[model samples]
Target: MVIINPTISTQPAALTRPAGPAPVLPADRVLNAVVLGERAQHLYELSSGSLRMMAESQTPLREGEQLQLRVLGKDAQQRPQLEILQRGTQDISPQLRNRLPEQLSLNQLSASLNQIRQGENPTLRQLIAPLLSSLPRRQQLSDSAGLQKALHNSGQSLEAKLASGEAPKGDIKAALLKLLATVQAQSPPPPKAGLARSYGPSNTPSPSVHAAGSAPADIATPGTASTAKSASAPQPQAASTAPAYQAPPKPLGLPGELQPQGRLPPSPPEIEGTLLSRLAHDVKGALARQDANQLLGLHSREHGGSYMIELPVRDRDGIDVWQFQFQPPRTERDHSHNERGSQHDTTQTGWTLSLSFDLPGLGAITARVTQQEKQLGIRFDAVQSDALELLRQHTPELHQRLAEKGIDVAGIDCRRRSAQALTESSYSLSALLRDQA
Candidate 1:
């Protein structure tokens, strides 16, 4: 006899495989692709993973920058002819949308790092200590070389360091990512059970049940004593043996463990949290914030706008987060830095460095330093009278230090910061610098 089995079917396989047809891109449908630089002059290579085509872009496009495109139509060669909607990082619209919801304030991250020296996790402490040590000391800001070093290690050039195929060993962002991964690995796996179950409900029942069926053949008859006494009577064969069922002694949260029918220990109103876990959360938030800042910087670059970096300086007292803003010359936007070179470095152009931070004895202070030729103009604003006086007293020493580095300071100006100072800094940095002067 022939038998046909219905246990297997090719229908399931057919359902899983997608229909053998190409995806349709309707005309004028918005698409996103990365610009792969110039093919020839104004012509650019644009790709959206599955497709690549060349299109002429009126606006200059940089390689590896994402572009928002709209499908206009196909060319005579059947290649996609597209219009550039938004260029360069989608103008970072996507980043702001995704990152802002998850980001925590940088101040919280600094506080967490401050507690690291006292952390019990030696592995975590070791991971971050090296990065912190790489940061420039406050004293290093007195000269140009040290300032450049600070800029390199500020975590702002982290992407550049990676793109250049160099190890970002001493970079703060790299270390934070490492720490985040380590801490995340320690998170307990989620419980897999669907619901509460009795003692090892997932385990197999014992084979002892088979023992009940393995009796002598004559045992069925009570009056078979005569037959049992016969010398030729067949002996009973042994049944397969297996260990009896045993309930595992694991906690309720663990897999295949029994959920006891008793009251559990009540959770407390508040409990002290672990340092490593807390630090992990803080690091995650800080990284998100960094991602947001980098996005903002990408959008600002086209306009020759300023970029801000928060440098956390750890000291004997505590960690202090200093904000530094660097603004390139306005003309620098039009011409590439390499192309401009010595021509742009002339005394006619100037660069601005603005700093804001708080000190142990001194109150909140802000400084704006402008460089023109070999000469520098320093303007400091302080909220406290004592802080202003102290800065004024140290102006001559600051001037002397800069002069030693061939940085001549025409004058050092100290002023009292007003209530409108924060307001001014938020709106126009130029105005803030002007008001300080």
Candidate 2:
């Protein structure tokens, strides 16, 4: 359409009739879109969602090309207007951006759970037990089927799984959600500000409370001592300044108040809620990072069949996480990556597999394997020199196993791990259970 100030902007007006109702996105929501069809006659179809007539873009718009846009509210005809925000899918979602700074870590959560497990509440313990039991054992990841199950339980695609009516099994995110809600339900709420203030500002303790081990029997007059024992006991210290938690009349998703918070509650009920809230924050943070990686796979220059999965396995020293990524081969019509221009390849029915994990003896290791036809090429990057040597020693057996699977081993190499190849446990997730397992 019309290009102004080097940006492609469009006024989405329906050609035949008024523009139809489009999907409602927040005014600041930014997303990516690809040109599916060729541009012709300068006339465009104003779709209800992704509204567009004359689109504003920084880059030249062509078929199969992708550009980013930010929702800018409705236009004169009440049609949505999207201003091109960036040129690629690399721009992370604002919701995710806000979450990154405040998110918690699973390592910390495991420690918190250990402390929380000491509580005497059998009901709370029941909720926590399933989560620990669901963790896969070290031996489970030895087979392909077990590995598949781990990937399925990562809890990234939870909403999609629930929406499809195919319940996800052992989804960690779903477990976190349930555990948080249950803990919140059972938690002993802290003292309310108004109720505490009514006790008066005098130095003597309130008549209703007797030091640390007392409960109010009946309401006493403000600033007046009811008994001799109450007059000698310490008066109510300044009421706790921190805000109190209130149960929503009808809860939606996790509230902002539940985000990973500081200071544990005094009672068992409160402690359970605090620990579970932190755990949920860490798990959901991983989900957000997984979503970002997936968005890149879809809108990046690659052929767009890419995935990242994180699996947490139970080991002798608590939990060890493993990461895996799969990328499908590119096609002839694939868009050029950066300045390389178009790459013409007729035969690319291959795939790439990458996995990173730390073992008892191997330390941190990342393995990348590319499969073309029946042939395979693999490279192992190990952080420790001893680990690299050990991996090299195992290559012969690894090659032998591939051959047994009818795979032609082209080459196998081991090298020191680089920063780029090093993987963290935070950004990997897959399935989300529809209901608690």
Candidate 3:
């Protein structure tokens, strides 16, 4: 064996290799994308899918795998026109199905996919992916081939027929030449307001839907002829008379008789108590004066299916109380708010409130609804232990539901952020309000 230099060691200083392809993305990482169109384009990220950077030759942009979109120009309406530079793998979603042209055959689409997969010259894999997924689910290549062939043949025949026409007759040629000369001799005319309808008879009446009017051989019913004659009359004034109103009555409503609406009968007076009104009053009083010290004792429940009492505490200085008004059905307060069953009126508070509620099947979770200008924004708070566990274990299912509504919640670390802030739970609000007053 050869003697190695003691200073150099056996490894030869381990030659460093350049970095390889990027690691595959986790399902929760949001992948940014740009949708380009003549009208409007969107730059967004898909939060719940895998993304991969393909080889440069396979997908063109100089960046190789990483795709960056450049917005070129805005149309008259200020919509963006975009162009993509790199290629990345994107997830197929039902929403992306609209990118394909109407009536594209599945076979043609498959061929297009093959072209993209092969990374051929001038191939656009990124552009092609959206179109492939968007084709109508019901389309079949075998069925469409016959129709496509017929159309191709018809186009060829039409071109041949146009080419095979005989030379124009002497008189016809002379007349056509004269007409052309006259047209050329005249100055271009100003555009008219409307064009005349040229396809059908000028006075053509709307077709009678009945079978009798469809064919000349069919015997006309007693009043059908008269009705047709009256409809075709030239005098508008006569057509507007009582005699013109003698058209046949329409068939009785639809095939099925109108089903009576099933509105819930009114609840008993005792069941519809003043609890909601009382709760609203307390919330309104605390929010209007911005009094943090205000507190209210409300009946609530816990996640273990036990009914308990909850005390809502607002900490601030105030003897001030305000009357609260409840708008009708549309504006009725939603009391099933939190695990403690406490409701918060952020709209009146100009702040955000998180309340947890224990419900069957869902266990417990807090819904944080914020008041922003004139609208109320709602989102789930991560306080519910059971719900967070479900989310962590079932990421894909959660993502699918959230994606349906275009929500990209990929970066949320639920386990790390699902703790509730500790606060004093004294439900004795009425006595406190009295003391402050």
Candidate 4:
């Protein structure tokens, strides 16, 4: 049986301070890691070369699991803290395959644009030649202007081509797709200012019509001799020579069509609502099936929002009761006022996911996982030190279970909290769920 020390002292060693600055690890720096062993409070001792440090994780790690970790910062004793970034090498292949098609299209567009920008006389006509015949007959008359201009600029015999009727229709659709991608990659010129109107015959004022007394009284007094004379004059026959406003030339592609930007648009309300609904349904299904594996996959802590899931996993000791609570996405409005009537801002973008479990011999345990920006932090309640110590002994198993559900265990922290505080926290979560129901 493995026994873990209840507490480890972390005070600075008694020595004169080194001159200059403390050597620090770069933030979010990635390092390859291998699990060495487990220590107190579910912490795993990890190594990279001569560097050895402890990391706390909710997910268990096997004795020799290879992993990548991003350095967060140094703990109190100056040991580097790291968060898991990725696991085994093969894990990312499927995700890359899912995105391969889009990546390929983007690569092609980038290459073509780079060639054009370098002034290479690429076969512009040949590039779009196949697209000409596939255009709808009606759209051909309208949308074919850009194509015609491109061909003409390339000195290609467009009329002769039409006469020959040799355009390959089968490749037209594919050519159009490529052309669309290229156009989207290019940045269009800035829009021209709107037309300016010229007032006719500056020598004569245009007739000023207004509601009675709407203008200043002096301007409204048209009956005055000078005003009547000015109004009655033939207005110099109003030179009738205003320049017509001409619109700026439209870009080569469809007029007034904005090129698609790279960023994704926000999800529509219906889609967001559907996602939440589906998530609820999936969670319910997982629970009904009594599948811890499925339930683990259903926990979405990234997007934020309340989620509850039960994990029923048995170890050598007994069945453990695992409960998860995810705080709803908190917005700026949520932090505008605290009980003290002062304004505060929460810089954290990600929500919190709290895990609570009951170990047969170790009493209650709570682990709070928080992600701020890209950094991950895990904090355990200090009231249940024994539970955490016991967990440390089973670190490998815990890591494996969490990994099965797609959760990455990062740095672990232990903080003291009173029983009252735990109760208050649970109450808030309970209230949130009740309101949502």
Provide the RMSD of all predictions against the true structure, rounded to 1 decimal: 25.6, 18.1, 33.3, 31.2
Candidate 2 at residue 88, lDDT? 44
Alpha-carbon shift of residue 37 in model 4 (angstroms): 55
lDDT score of residue 13 within candidate 4: 23
For model 1, how does the per-residue alpha-carbon lDDT over 148-266 read when each residue is reduced to its tens digit? 77767767778777545468866777777776887667643222332112111223322211222221332211111233343474533223122112222211111001111111122
> Candidate order by lDDT, highest to lowest?
1, 2, 4, 3
Report the C-alpha lDDT of model 2 over 132-202, residue by residue, as the tens digit.
77767788888989877776777666655654556767887677666666655655454454433332223
Q: What do the candidate models score in CA lDDT, each in turn? A: 0.53, 0.50, 0.27, 0.38
Q: Residue-wise lDDT of candidate 4 within 244-325, one digit each (tens)?
A: 2221111111000111112111222222222222222222222222222122122223224354433332233222334445
Number of clashes found in candidate 3: 12
* Two-way TM-score contest, 3 vs 4, winner: 4
Clashes of each: 0, 11, 12, 6
Residue 60, model 1: Cα distance from true site in angstroms: 18
Output the better candidate (3/4) by lDDT: 4
Best first by TM-score, ranked: 1, 2, 4, 3
Clashes of 1: 0
Highest-lDDT candidate = 1
Which model scores highest in TM-score?
1
